[model samples]
Target: MVRSAYERGVTTLTLDSPHNRNALSKGLVAGLRAGLAQAAADDAVRAVLLTHTGNTFCAGADLREGSGSPAELAALLRSIVELPKPVVARVEGHVRAGGTGLLGACDISVAGPGASFAFTEARIGVAPAVISMPLLPRLDARAAARYYLTGERFGAAEAARIGLVTLAAEEGADGGTGASGKGVDALLEPVLDGLRRGSPQGLAESKRLVTAEVLRTFDRDTDSLAELSARLFASDEAREGMTAFLERREPAWVP
Candidate 1:
C-alpha cells in the first residue's frame, strides 16, 4: 500500500492504495512505519517525502475494519516527528481525520490549490483524540478548536492561513507541465534542495529542538488517547454514525 523510491538524497514514500483512497489500513500503516525506519537508517538519505497516488490524499482510518487501536497510526506520526531527516508532505488532494495527523507530523507540508482538509471525527461521534497530539502544535488554537468541534471541510488556502500547511501553491505555479503530480514536484524540488544542504546532525538537532514538547506530550498520553479513540469507535453512537454514513442517511442523533 506504500511505495518507496530514492533519488538525489531524498526518499519518497507514496501511499498507493487508490482503491481505498489510501485509507490508513493496518497494512498501509505498517508499510509507512517501515519506510520511515528504512529512511532513518540510510546515510545517503537527507529527507523524506510523503505523497499519495490517488485523487484523495487519505480518507482516514478504515472504519470498515472496525478495529480502533490507533496505536500504529500514532507510531507512524511519532516516527515522523522524531525522524532525523526532514519529512515533507506533498498534498494534492483531500486529507481527512487520521490523515491530518500524518500531515501535521511532517516538518513541512505543501498543498496544491485543489487540496482540501477536514477533521471529520466529530461527525462520526468520535473525537480527534490521537491526532490532536500532533495537530494541536501545528495549527492555530482557535482554528483548531473550530474545525475539531465542527468537522467541517476547509480549503488549502485557509489551511495555510491557519498554519496547518506550510505553503499553498496555485495550479501550475511550480512551472510544471500541469500533469497530475508535477505540481507537487514543483513545490517539492526547492524544499528537497534546501534539505539536502543541511548537515545530518544539524537537521536532526534542529528537529529535536522544535518537536521536543510534542514528543513529550505524545509519549506521556499516547496510550490513553488510543484507548479513548478505540472506545469511541466501538461505542453505540459511533456505530450509528458509521452505519448512517455508509447507508447515505443522516445519523439518528442528528436533529
Candidate 2:
C-alpha cells in the first residue's frame, strides 16, 4: 500500500506492507508511480522521502508471484529514475536484490548500521538488468561489476564505502531509529530542512539537467547491455540455476 504524509513542506511516501517485507508487486509499483506523480504535481511538496514499513525496508520483488514481465520492471525503473523531486530512501534494514536498486535510484540514501545490502539476482538465476541501470550510476564501476557478478551480501558501511549509500548511520543515529512513524519523522526532518533552504526552481532545473546528461550517456551504451541481459535470462543456464535455487539444491552452474 502507499501512504503519504506532508509535514513542513516535505512529502513522505511509504511502502507499507509488513507481510512479504514490502515486496514490490505490480500493485505496489502502480501505487508508487501514482504517489510520486502526485508529489511532483503538488506545489506544496518540495521534497520526498521514500521509506517502508516493517523491519526490512523491502525484500525486493514478489518472486512467489513470478518475476515481473520485463516491460513492467523497465517501466517502474524508468519512473524512479525520472522522478522530479529529490527522493531520499531511509533504509532501516537489509536491502537486497531489487531493494538495492530502489535505494540506488534515489537522489540520496541514509541507511542504518543494521541495514545490509546485496545483489542476489545471480544466485536466483536472474539478470540484474534494470537494477543495473541505477546501481551503476550510484556505485563505483568495479564495485558494481563485482557485486553484480558475485551477489555477495555487504554491510551498510561497505555500501557507503563503495558509494552505493551516501550516508551510514550509527545505531541511535538518523536511520537506525527503526521504521516507526516517529522515527521516520525524525529522520526526514534534516533532509527537509536542507531542501527548504534551497531554491525549488533551481533544484528542479539542476536535477533535470543532470538526468539529461546521465540518460544521454546511458543511451549510447545500453543497447549492448540490454541484449546481454536478455540473452542471459533466456539461457538454459539461468533456468537451471533458478530451478536449483527454488529446489534448495546446488546449482549445476556452481562448482
lDDT of 1 by residue, 92-172 (tens): 899999899898899999998778899988888898899889889779999999999998899877888898888777555
Candidate 2 vs. true structure, TM-score = 0.84
What C-alpha lDDT does candidate 1 achieve relative to the native structure? 0.87
Relative to the true structure, candidate 2 has a C-alpha RMSD (angstroms) of 4.0
Worst lDDT 10-window in candidate 2: 175-184
* Top candidate by TM-score: 1
Best-matching candidate per lDDT: 1
Q: What is the lDDT of residue 134 in candidate 1?
A: 89
Give the poorly placed runs of model 1, Cα more than 4 Å off.
171-183
Give the Cα-based TM-score of candidate 1 against the true structure: 0.93
Residue 23's lDDT within candidate 1 is 88
The lDDT per prediction is 0.87, 0.74
What's each prediction's TM-score? Answer: 0.93, 0.84
Candidate 1 clashes between residue pairs 3 or more apart in a chain or in different chains: none
Q: List all candidate RMSDs to the true structure.
A: 3.1, 4.0
